[model samples]
Target: MKKIEAIIRQETLDDLKDAMLNTFEENPIGMTVTQVLGFGHQKGLKDYVRGQEVITSFVPKIKVGFVLEDKCVEQMIDLIVKTCQTGNVGDGKIFVYPVEEAVRIRTGERGESAI
Candidate 1:
């Protein structure tokens, strides 16, 4: 199994979810999203505070992730990239990681079935 994590622009949530659901029709895909703040190459954003320039090192972003079969990781990443593209910086990033295990508590299912 693999875990796909995509940090995307705050405004593209609906579009990304719709596109992913349409693609994963044969099997249901579930994901979790969280609001996070961080900085990367863009170094965050600047704002005016009391007539003075202030640089904020942390910017808001949406983190979307799900654990699925390893084969599905690449496609998921591609969809995220396509949906979130804006031809500008801070488009965000996608990461894939190996998942050691998964468990469904209520059913006591494990492995791919648990996912």
Candidate 2:
């Protein structure tokens, strides 16, 4: 099993979710979304108006995570990349890792089956 974490622009969340749902079976994957603040090389800055400056320190980003079968990793990554790409800064990132184990709270099922 593998865990895929994709940090992307908030605008792309709906598209990403729809694409993933179309590709996977109902509830075959579990997902979570979080709001995060961050900055990259271009970092945010303050905007000045009427001789006053307003600090804008960080960029808003959406982080999406899901657990899926190892075999599904490549496709899932592709889907995310395609849906999230904006050809601009702050498109965000994707991280993948191996899962040691997973458990179903109600049934106590373990391993890939639990996911």
Candidate 3:
């Protein structure tokens, strides 16, 4: 199985969730949301009118995650890219990794079945 993690603009969370729900069967997928802060090459610097320092600090972002079959990876990535794109900075990023194993808490089922 593959674990897909996407860090995206918080503003796009609702739309992304709605799209995923529509695309997949109910209960076949799981999702998580977490608040995050970070900056890229642009950094947190911003120009000021009076030459005063404006500390942007960390920018707010949302982290979304789920487990899916290998076949579903590309589709999921496409959906996220399409839904999250705004042609602007801080659009966020996506990461994928192989899950060593998964186990169901109640039934103790393992592997892809556990997911």
Candidate 4:
């Protein structure tokens, strides 16, 4: 198993979800979506507050993550890039990690079946 995590622009969440749901038709995909604050080269944005300029160093982003079979990792990465890329600096990042194991609490299922 592998874990794929993507930090993406907030506006692209819906499109990413639709693409993943449509492409993975054979099996239901389980995922977690979290609202997060982060910064890259873009370094957040400048805004006016109370007639003063303010730089918010942490920008709002969406973190989408899931654990799935190793065979599907590349496919998911492609889908994420295709669905989220905007040719902009703050588009966000994708990270893949090795998963040691997985367990389903209700059924005591382990390994890929548990995923």
TM-score of each: 0.92, 0.89, 0.88, 0.95
Off by over 4 Å in 4: none
Better TM-score candidate (2, 4): 4
lDDT of the candidates, in the order given: 0.92, 0.88, 0.88, 0.94
> By descending lDDT, how would the candidates be arranged?
4, 1, 3, 2
Worst 10 residues of 1 by lDDT: 70-79
- Would you list the rank order by TM-score, best first? 4, 1, 2, 3
Cα lDDT tens digits for candidate 4, 1-90 = 899999999999999988889999888779899999989899889999999999999999999998989889999999999999999899
Clashes of each: 0, 0, 0, 0
* Candidate 2 regions with alpha-carbon error over 4 angstroms: 45-51
The CA lDDT at 69 in model 3 is 82
Candidate 1: tens digits of C-alpha lDDT, residues 1-115: 9998888899999999999899998897999999999989889899999999999999999999999898888888888989999989999999888999999999999999998
Residue 7 of candidate 4: its Cα lDDT?
Answer: 98
Tens-place lDDT digits, model 2, residues 52-81: 988788978898999988889999999999
Model 4 per-residue lDDT at 6: 97
Q: In model 2, how large is the Cα lDDT of residue 38?
A: 83
* lDDT value, residue 56 of candidate 1: 91
